[model samples]
Target: MTRNTLEQEYDIVVIGGGTAGPMAAIKAKERNRDLRVLLVDKANVKRSGAISMGMDGLNNA
Candidate 1:
């Protein structure tokens, strides 16, 4: 890694692995089966966003 490394390569790099990122990655993958997809964010992406803050905006909404 380098201090100036914004990025070097990637077919697609999505920030904020929320509902959109995952869906985008999935769609991009479907569009090009050979593409390399990356989902990244400062927050814990493994856990769904918004809902993690004790806000059930999507929970049965």
Candidate 2:
């Protein structure tokens, strides 16, 4: 097996790509366009988390 190394720097790092995670990252970047915002999630960002699992039901209610 081979090992791969990755390194990056960011002003803000948001854990989770859930409902709030993405919004928070967007807001941070809006506040400071120069900021390097990083959003990390264990699962696929697009179709994962509460939003994917029908959290919008709560909002609609």
TM-score of each: 0.57, 0.73
What lDDT tens digits, residue by residue, belong to model 1 across residues 13-49? 9776545656677788889999987767566633566
Off by over 4 Å in 2: 53-61
Model 2, 1-61: lDDT tens per residue? Answer: 9999999899999887677877788788789999998877777644566674665442222
Clashing pairs in 2: none
**Residue 6 of model 2, lDDT score:** 100
Q: Give all candidates' CA lDDT scores.
A: 0.62, 0.72
**TM value for model 1:** 0.57
| Predicted structure 2, TM vs. truth | 0.73
Per-residue error at 12 for model 1, in Å? 0.8
